[model samples]
Target: MTALATAPTARPRPARAWRAVMRLHRPALIFWGFFVSVVSAVLLWAYGPGGNAAAAAWQRPCTVDLCDVGYAVDIYHLAYRFCEALITFLPVLVAVWAGGLLIGRELENGTAELAWSQSVSPARWLATKLAVPAALLTAGTTLLVLLHRLLFDAHQVPKGWNWSDNGTFEANGPIAVAFPLLALALGALSGLIAGRALPGLIAGILATATASTLIGLAGPHLVPWKTSVGDLKEGYAAPSGVIYGREGAVTSTGAHIPDPCTGAGKACPAAHDIVGYYSEYHPSSQFWALQLTQTALILTVAALATAAAFTLLRRRTS
Candidate 1:
């Protein structure tokens, strides 16, 4: 009797906040898992059976006038396009999930408040929410990027689908992982600002879209753009075979010039004193450099957004 009376009760364990987060967003998790599985299967098919079919189709000479100008729409090409679109649009999907299905729904339905009331700090709750999904997103995107690079290296890519291509560059490197994280961070910030489901969803999508547009516009300037000066009469062609940048005329004295004429005529050549042209481009050798630089910038933006989110949560909770 004395032992029973003096015995201490075991304290209840702290709530498993991460597990609660997973439970709250189980549907989104399921969808993401299904999507990753399907994409992995498609990529594997591209590397295996589809590759053989595409190779066979490429060997057949074209009898028509078009000839090799256009390759046949083979299974491999289809798979390649599928991978491109999948990696490219992944960020948007992340935005939607983070906004509507994660925080938006919780905030709208008062579940966030309820969770905070039940022994969970707002910051910790939000951190768990962001951290789990971010880990999964990073893993999924990195796997897809690796598979994409493998497939691209093993076969002949379409003329415009090289490393210099926008979709190709994004899908083949760390940018694939970084961009989704940026979208997720932006989505969370949007959700906190809007505080309602539909509005938050819309805001998140728009925010992601805006970030993408800004990046597209500003990306070229971020890296060291190589300017190749060549004879105007000889015409300028990229030495590296990849030219994803602007071209304009330059004088013998290295002064910048603008061409007034549109068509290729004698007047067009003489109008701007165009002795030569400068082609600003990123060479194939700079692929990894540009990718790493862009990734760092994107991650920085993500970090800022995440910090802002915590601050916002703190203010609201306080």
Candidate 2:
């Protein structure tokens, strides 16, 4: 009688289902692990303020500065800086969610009958399956952001220039958040909607790639608008005298009369380089706010995916 009474129970928590789902994603996990390991080291090494010698070999004089000096940064900095763009591609990779082939996998393998006959309920089973991937991905993204902040300053001033420019993601703060969320959602959506694993994977990848391309092209207008004094029209001034005119003690030097555009040249000192107008460019706080908002939106997508898959599973015929 006790054995009979103990026969009934809802599925073990969603966690078991979540783990089962994760088992199918070993390839993706490997890819992520390899990527994180390789990229983390690269980022840490590349962002070091100083490293590598061959970079000095690439330095060159600027055409607008007052001196012959040029901007300076090591080759590693350039490499690390390139990492900033990685967030954009994250979406394409993340779109492979557990939703696709989740029900389909069970149906195809004919395991739903045996599994559902046990203590698990459909919703709980689905919920548990999605938790692992979602949590791990989010954690990974957070770590990446912290690393970015730790190794680099929000506002960067390059050498040979006092201008507070060349900063990271000054253009769009939301970019980071939106892309990652987009990736995760896409993955899950593809997996769930595209029943077959291959098809679902492709759909996720393609969707992410498409969005990434559009954002890359149009992100400029969406970010912070940092004010800059770079738009002023410049004019060079010539010497006041023409080579001393061969008389009267040769006291006068070159004379540069200001001209408008073509007629707009200032009398620049001989020691100085070319002078030009610089446009005023400054980033607004809205830039960061927008980015943060975008991040939230993305994260929400992941949560939604989990909810959606659970709902679908609960109503599944199998």
Clashes of 1: 0
Local accuracy of candidate 2 as per-residue lDDT tens digits, 209-265 = 775565544444444433222112322222221111111111123222232243334
Instruction: Please identify model 1 stretches exceeding 4 Å from their true place.
Output: 1-7, 61-73, 156-160, 239-241
TM-score of each: 0.91, 0.57
Best by lDDT: 1
lDDT of 2 at 111: 63
Model 2 segments beyond 4 Å from truth? 1-24, 49-74, 97-114, 154-178, 209-284, 300-307
State each model's CA lDDT, in order.
0.82, 0.50
Residue lDDT tens for model 1, 1-318: 456456688999975877877787888889889988988888888888777666667666788665562343455777888888988999998898788768887899999998899898899889998999999999988899989888888875344356777688889899999999999999998889888878888888998899888876777678888877778666665576564678777776788666454477777666666687777788888888888888888888889989999999999999
